[model samples]
Target: MLLCFVDESDQGDFHGFAGLMADEHATKAITDSLNRTMRQVAVDWGIPATTELHGHPIFHNKEDWKHVPTRVRVGVFHKVFEAIVAEDVVILLRWVHVTRLAERQARNFYPVNFPPEQVCFQHILQRAQQVSATRDTYTLIIADDRHDRDRHRERFATYQTEGTPGVYMQTNLDRLLDTVHFAPSHMSRMLQAADMLAFIYRRVHTVTESDPRASREMAKLWNTLVDSGRVHNEGNWP
Candidate 1:
């Protein structure tokens, strides 16, 4: 079995879900690796490593990371991504251009409009299902807790029973083992890892750094994911 832990990030222009997938047996090892990276960064930055590593605050100079220097925080961010790349994990990403989506909606696009959350999520689920196929196994999705948990579970149940909007995709999620599950990110190291990934994903794709040095750091971090060859199922819808 596979465990797919994911988190979401939505800027006005786009909405995305990105995270790591690990073999059922490898989750603890991956978590330990990530924790080690966090512990080192915490020691260096003078913050508790056990505190949740939230990407938005870390990158935006908010909360626990505010006292840390921008360059230091950026370096820490790079290190975390590096650890993720070094692990036995598969990276998944999917998003949609909401700015364009709104324009289409204004024109009275069919079915009101495409819901970014559901669309990107289903896309990722299908991708995870494909990954599961390689091992002749199944995937169980676990996401960072959100206010819309019940709603997402309902949609997932429907998709499994009735088939996902056939007009957009054709697979029926036979490899997906159960309805979506949720957990508080702060309580789960893996979910927080997903949060960091989703945050960087939004920052890299929709938000850009005005500082040249920081921009370079972000590029290097993304390059690590690309070069590692673990990044899979990445896409942005029109």
Candidate 2:
């Protein structure tokens, strides 16, 4: 069985969905290693073990994140990235430029107005289906539980039963997802990894327009993912 951990990073202007797909047996080991590395970093920074390691706070320097020394923060960021890269994980991402989407809506490009979240979800599902077919294995999707969990669940159920509104015949639900599950991000290290990757992709794509340092760091991370051949991006809008 393949376990896919999914998360989203929606920064108003930029919205992205990311997933980490790995074999079910290897997922626990990967999460444990990540948690251990993060805990060690936290201890070195004098932060409590219970503290969450979110991407924005660690990379963008928010809240108590400022307490971590710059060098240590960068070290932890790279360490986490490297650890994730070292694992037998495949990264999949779907990015939507909200402004571009709004423009398309104004032009009436779509018969039905689809939310960015839904668009991202659909793309991820498509990718999941392709992966499942290629590996000939069942795939389970686990997403970070959000306030709109019920809404997402309802949408997913509809997709499974009726497919998407505009192109019902195009989506093959039966072969795609075995199930969709939700869990709190704090409780799932895999979900946390998805959050970081999504955050990095969003920040690198949008914030690089303004921040030089972010531009540099994002370039580095982007190169690492691309060069490793384990990451894929769907529908990146300029």
Candidate 3:
């Protein structure tokens, strides 16, 4: 079985859906490695050892991130990225620029009621099925719990039963397991990694347009995932 840990970044101008897919056998090792890296980074930075690693704060300079020195902050970020890349994992992402989506809706080119979250989930489900097919294994999606947990769960159930409409040519219901699981970010290191991936990709595409240094740093990480042939993107809608 393959376990896919999913998370999203909906801040600022871009929204991103990303997940880390790893074999069930390797999941523990990957998460442990991530935990170790995070703990070590905290120790090195002289922060509380129990502090949780959150991508938004670390990348966007919020919360605990503001307390850490710039070099330490960047170091932790790179270390976490390296930990995931070193493991046997596949990163999956679907990003959308909200402004462009809104513009498309305003022009009647896209459905007004079809929110970016829905589009992102549909793409993730499709990708999960594809990954499951190639691996000849079943996939269980474990996503970061959100305020809209009930709604998201209901949607997943609907998709499992009815299949996704107006998105894929045909509904894929075989490879993915019926139920979607949710967990808090701090509870799962894999989820933390997923959060980082989504946040980094969204930040790179949305917020760094004019900042060359920021763009270079973000793009370097983003491109590494892109070159791995495991990450996928669903471009903006018409």
* Best model per lDDT: 1
List model 3 lDDT by residue over 1-238, tens digit each: 8888999887765677887888865688767876787677677766665566787787666776777776666666777777677777778878666778778678876544577887777778788788778778888889999888888888787877887766553565578786788899887878888888877867766674576766677777777776667664445443
lDDT of 1 by residue, 136-189 (tens): 988889999889899989988888888887556567788988789999998887
Determine which window of 10 residues in candidate 2 has minimal summed lDDT: 167-176
Q: Which ranges in model 3 have alpha carbons more than 4 Å from their true place?
A: 99-112, 167-169, 209-212
lDDT of 3 at 172: 52
The digit string of per-residue lDDT tens for model 2 on 18-119 reads 988888656877777777877886778777766666888887677767878776776666766777888777899888788887788779766677777877
- TM agreement with the true structure for every prediction: 0.92, 0.89, 0.87
Models sorted by lDDT, best on top: 1, 2, 3
TM-score of model 1 (CA atoms) = 0.92
TM-score-sorted candidate list, best first: 1, 2, 3
Count of steric clashes across candidates, in order: 0, 0, 0
lDDT, candidates in the order shown: 0.83, 0.77, 0.75
Q: What's the lDDT for residue 149 in model 1? A: 91
Q: Report how far off residue 75 is in candidate 3 (Å).
A: 1.5
Model 3 misses residue 35 by how many Å?
A: 1.7
Output the TM-score of candidate 2. 0.89
